[model samples]
Target: MTTLLEARGLTADRPGDEGPVRVLDSVDLALESGTLTELVGPSGAGKTTLLLALARLLPDARGSLALDGVPAEEIDIPAWRMRVALLPQRPTMFAGTVAENLRVPWRLGVRSAESPPDDTALREALDRAGLSGVALERGATRLSVGQAARVALLRVLLTRPRVLLLDEPDASLDDASAEQVRRFTAEFVSGGGAAVRVSHARSDDAADRRVRLTGGRLEEVGRA
Candidate 1:
């Protein structure tokens, strides 16, 4: 598989009320196209930090990141972000309806170059996420956490990002919804998409590699 994303000496820190504290240290990783990589570790082990770094969303991040063999900095921030979509652990929705939220990608200049997914595609994504009851016209705020997560994921998927950085996407999902997530991720990789999923729990989803962190450092590197 071609390398879609790569990081070397990835490090990050958090600025709290007290001061800046280190959260990640010298993390080296690569994400290959057509594969899923699971980032597994204990809580506060920097899993989310790593994911944000991969998506170039962290202000405290200090490291080298490349996309398709090109330095990420060379790419426009907006374009880079759209290509490497990061789904936060707690996804927020717009004040408008679900359909309105789904239409946001088209409103962005960075993403407008690519045609937005049609209503049929959006509805199919929602259905696959087991959210058929979430009418597009329904207020986004009315969604449950699990439903919101799915909706957020579907929104990202509609953008056709080259890489997906998901933070514990299944943490709030029920068994049925979780199954849908697993299936969608698996199929995504199988169809030449790349993704990094942050999860502490071991799941049945297929991943090409496992990157483990402990105490804010790379601890184990294994294949799945």
Candidate 2:
């Protein structure tokens, strides 16, 4: 498989009361097309920092980041983001109907209408996320925690980015909803996309690789 993203000597830190708090330390990792890499770590292990660094969302991050052999800095922020999106742990929903929330990306014109999924396509995506029978015309704010997470995942899928950076997407989900998320990720990688999931779950579907972090450091790597 071709490498979709790569990082080397990636390091990061944030301000602390006493001084600087080391978050990520000399981390090295790679994400390939058609693969799912699970990132596991204890709390405060800098997993979020690492993902933010890869997404170029961290200003204090230092090191090299590349996408498809191209330096990330060389790619325009907007274009790069379109290709690589970060699905935060906390799903954000606009104050509107579910359909309106999903359509916001298209309405903003940042994403091409011809590329995004149409109404039927959106419903299918929703169904795949265990949101089948969901009324798109209903208020988005009415969705529960798990439903909101799944909806957020579906929304991102509409953009069809090459890579997904998920931060504990199933944290607030039930067993069935979590399984839906797992299946969604599997199908995504099977379809030529890649994903890096930051999860605390003890077990999950077979992953191509497991990147484990300890005390903000790369402790070990478990390969399939």
Best by lDDT: 2
Q: Candidate 2 lDDT, tens digit per residue, 1-224?
A: 99999999899989989999988888888899999999998888889888888888998898899999999879988788888889998999999988777876676556764555578877877877778878888799999988889888888877789999999988888899888889988988999998999989645666788889887778547878
Best TM-score goes to which candidate?
2
Q: What is the lDDT for 126 in model 2?
A: 81
For candidate 2, the lDDT comes to 0.85
- The lowest-lDDT stretch of 10 consecutive residues in candidate 2 is 108-117
Question: Which ranges in model 2 have alpha carbons more than 4 Å from their true place?
Answer: 112-116
TM-score of 1: 0.92
Assess candidate 1 and give its lDDT: 0.84
